[model samples]
Target: MNIKTEFSDKTLTAIIEGDIDHHTAKGIRETIDLAVEEKNPSALTLDFGNVQFMDSSGIGLIMGRYRLMKLLNGNLELVNLPEHINRLISLSGLFSLDIIKNKGCEQIETRE
Candidate 1:
């Protein structure tokens, strides 16, 4: 997978592309972690809009980031999730903490 990062305010946006599988999840995790450590943002946005395919590894990757953000007292949000991917996240019970959105518009309301 390819990761593109952008920052606005204190939020770091990681735009992930390509298939996220076991072969790629580690690099993604490490890259994002490093970015977070360097940027020290208050929030992190994982843009999955360009991700073509995902498996269980994707869930693990996201959960890892969620835990990392928790330790930092920050937040993690998901943007531009496809229907199937959204369903996967919902089924995995990850939507409870992560905000899943479409076209930069968030459908899931988060209260914190």
Candidate 2:
């Protein structure tokens, strides 16, 4: 899996590509955590547009990040989720965590 991060106006966007399984989750988590610590963004967006597959580890990754953002009084958004992954997230009860969804053209305000 490849993880690319973009920081703008205190918002850190991590565009994740490829499958997220146990093998890749550790590296992905470390990368994202480091970015979050460095940027200290008030919001985070995990763009899963290119993610093809995910296992339970993916859910753990998301949950962990959610906690991290909450601790910093920030927010976490999940965008461009493929239908299968969306179902997995929903089935995992992750929706109750107040994960923001980017639908359509509505942009997420990062700085102001």
Candidate 3:
């Protein structure tokens, strides 16, 4: 897995690519957490557009990040989710928790 982060306007965006499984989730979490602590962004956007596969570990990753953001008085957003990943989130019952702040946006647009 590969995770890239960008910070601006009090928001941190992480573009995650590849599969999110038990092996990769932990590394991704650590990387994101480091960025969050350094940037302290009011909002965090996890862009899953390039993610191809995900298991329960993905749910864990999301949950952990959600908790982290809340603890920091920030918010978390998931975007650009492909159909399979969306279904996983729904089936995992994450949506019921309202973890996804902006479900209307199919993708997070970035400024060049």
lDDT of 1 by residue, 1-112 (tens): 4988888899999999999999999888888999999999999999998898999999999999988988999988888887667768877898677465567543543335
What lDDT is reached at residue 40 by model 2? 97
Q: Estimate each model's TM-score.
A: 0.87, 0.89, 0.87
After the best TM-score superposition of candidate 1, give how far the Cα of residue 69 lies from its true spot, in angstroms. Answer: 0.6
Name every residue pair that clashes in candidate 2: none
In model 3, where do residues sit more than 4 Å from their true spots?
Answer: 101-112
Report every candidate's CA lDDT: 0.86, 0.88, 0.86
Worst 10 residues of 1 by lDDT: 103-112
- TM-score order, best first, reads 2, 1, 3
**What are the runs in model 1 whose C-alpha is more than 4 Å off?**
104-112
Q: What TM-score does model 3 achieve against the real structure?
A: 0.87
Error of 1 at 53 (Å): 0.2
Name the top TM-score candidate.
2
- Quote the RMSD, in angstroms, for model 2: 7.2
